[model samples]
Target: MIDSHIHADTRPYEDFEMMAISGIEKAITCAHDPLPMKSAVVTLEHISRLQKLDVKRAQENGIDLYVAAGIHPRAIPTDYEKVINKLPSILNNPKVVAIGEIGLEKGSKEELKIFKEQIKLADKLKVPVIIHTPRKNKEKVIDTILSLLSENLDESLAVIDHIDDKVVDKVVDRECMLGLTIQPGKLTIDKAITILEEYGVDKFMLNSDMSSAPSDPLSVPKTVHKMRLKDFNDSEIAKVSYKNAEKFFKL
Candidate 1:
């Protein structure tokens, strides 16, 4: 299975082994802003860590690691243009899959500006994107993101992530895919199954969003087990746990 979204850079090295043991064969580690950004260099350094260190670490532990490199909305720095200029080359790394973990936080003009720039960059490069929706005012923030996606992005290449029931209906009809992150403060397994049943499995994928916060590295596999216990079919389970991510990320 592919853990569709994670931050292996912030996790201990052992978590990779545990995830592999839990049946995760591949994972996508996205760029995260752990602290306030000082410069574009810091963002580049973070992406480099995912590209080199995290990939090596995950591989050593028996999981194939892919990267999504971009400036996360909360991590956009003053010289963000510098990072933007370097992104095409950074994304050229074979391990990099999407331009991601980018979207609205406070919905500030600056945040929107950075978000738009990255969206355009992804579009220009013909790569996929992983968009983030904030914890507070998610309704408002998702609406704004949907507006930008409709105007600037190919629905097939966009992933609106960290969805809950509150906002799932808003995104279901769109052609873009959805991400259900099974992390603390996100959807529980029961809730995720509810969404899957309601929305069907065609466009939904499982993710852990694993990072410094309390998270289960085995979330995707655990959710797969839960699905098996229920009435879900093998085809349905495969779509959410593996095939959807494989087709979406082209990994």
Candidate 2:
């Protein structure tokens, strides 16, 4: 199984071991807001760690890890353009899969600007993107994200992540993939299954979005177990558990 989204840099090495043991064969670690992102230099260092240190850690623990580097909205620095300028070179790394975990947080002008810039970069590079939607005003934020995506990005090249029932309908027919983040304070396993049943598994993927927040690295495998018990066919299970992500990220 491929956990479509997570912050492996913030997780312990042991978590990767647990993930491997639980049947996660691969995972994608996305760039996120490391609070108090003071400068472009700090953000660059964070991206470096995701590409270098975290990738090695996951490999050592028996997981094939890929990376998505970008300026997260909450981590937007004053000199964010500097980071954008350097992303082309950084994304050239073979293990880098997408430009992601990037999108509206507070939905400020500055946030939208940075989000658009990264989307443009991803589109220009012809790479997939992992888009984030915030918890507060989720519907509004998702609508804004959808609008931006419709106007600026090829919907097929983006995955609108952290989708719950509230906004799932909005993204379902957008010609993009949807990420159901199974974690505490997020979509529970049962809800995820329901979404899959209703929407079909073709354009959806499962992820933990694990970070410092209460999370489970074993989420994807656990969901797979539950899906099997619920009598979902192997093809349906495979689509959400791994195939969608593999095809989207070209992994």
Candidate 3:
């Protein structure tokens, strides 16, 4: 199974081995933009370097690795200008599947401007996008993103991640893909399955956004197991756990 969204770049290298052992066969590791906070110092060049190491490490460990490039909402104030200028070349790398982990968080003017720019960049480059929604005022953020994309772009090319029941209906109505992240203090396995059960798994996928924070690397596999226990058939599990992501990201 491909963990459709993960920050494997920030975890210990052994995390890959753990993923393989836990039944995660592949992952799409995202490069976060630099933030003012002490922990966020990733630049485009930094993403490239990490992508190289990550791909090599995944191969050595017998796991497949795909990459996504973008500046996160928190990092916009720090590296937005230079990063945007260089993101085009950075994304040219064959392994980079989308331009994201980018979206609105603080809903600041600059954040919205950069988020729109990255979405445009994804469109210009003919690639998909993975977005991060604001923890606060999430419905407003989702509205802002959909409104921005409704005009010229295909909603299917964008993955509105970090979603919950609050905005799931809006996203589904917009015809965009939904990403459910299973992490501590966020969405859980039970809730994820419940969302799928209510919404049905068409343009949905599950992810273990396990990174530097407190999270479980085995979360994705566990969700898969839990879904089966809930009597989600193999095809349904394959859709949310693997096939949908494969179709969306072309991975």
36-103, model 3: which lDDT tens digit per residue?
A: 52332446555776579878987777679989888887765454677777778877787888887888
Where in model 3 is the C-alpha error above 4 Å?
33-42, 77-79
Specify the poorest-scoring 10-residue window by lDDT in model 2: 33-42
For candidate 3, the clash count comes to 1
- Tens digits of per-residue lDDT, candidate 2, 1-251, equal 99999999889889999999898999999999866777999999999999999999999999999999998988988899999999899888999989988999989999999999889888888889999999889999988888888888888999999999988888888888899999988899999999998989998999999999899898889999999999999999999999989999989
lDDT on C-alpha atoms for all candidate structures? 0.92, 0.91, 0.81
Worst 10-residue lDDT window, candidate 1: 29-38
Cα lDDT of candidate 1 equals 0.92
The TM-score, computed over Cα atoms with residue i paired to residue i, of candidate 1 is 0.98
What tens digits encode model 1's per-residue C-alpha lDDT throughout 1-251? 99999999889999999999998999999987986778988888888888999999999999999999888988988999999899899888889999988999989999989899999888888999999998789999999999998888888899999999999999999989999999889899999999998889998999999998899898899899999998899999999999999999999
Please state the error at residue 56 of candidate 3 in Å.
2.0
The residue pairs found clashing in candidate 2 are none
lDDT leader = 1
